[model samples]
Target: MPTITIKNIPEELYEALKSTAENHHRSINSEVIIRLEQALLPRLKTPKDKLTNIQRLRAQISPNVISADDIDDIINNGRA
Candidate 1:
């Protein structure tokens, strides 16, 4: 196993990492390794796969419950 040292981590970031490690019952080093793996490795999804997921989620929503006007109003309200 290789050992490395990280220098000059921001106080807030270090605290956040420490808190997350404690919450998940892991040591800081383990938490860092898990986070690094997630950052470096990602799952590849095809366009068809993504579209299928979108369609599945959209199918769960009831039809005609909210009108287009309601959606527009919701969007405009957020801008004010």
Candidate 2:
């Protein structure tokens, strides 16, 4: 195993990292390693993963469906 030292980390960033590590029940070093891996290692998403992510994001949105008529009314009346 190799050891590394990081210097001059901003106070706010350190605090945020510390808070996140505590929330996840991880040590600061482990949190840094996890974060570094996430930033440096890119993984290809499978079709199912992509669909799941899209569905998850869509679920957060309001269910209001806008129609063409509604769009025309908004454009003409300058109202949402």
Off by over 4 Å in 2: 52-80
Residue lDDT tens for model 1, 4-80:
99999999999999999999999999999999988898768999999999999999999999999999999999999
Poorly placed runs, candidate 1 (over 4 Å): 45-80
Quote each prediction's TM-score.
Answer: 0.55, 0.60
Encode model 2's per-residue lDDT on 3-33: one tens digit a residue: 9999999999999999999999999999999
Clashes of each: 0, 0
Best by lDDT: 1
Q: After superposition, how far is residue 15 of candidate 1 from its true place, in Å?
A: 0.2
Worst 10 residues of 2 by lDDT: 71-80
lDDT of each: 0.97, 0.95
Best-matching candidate per TM-score = 2
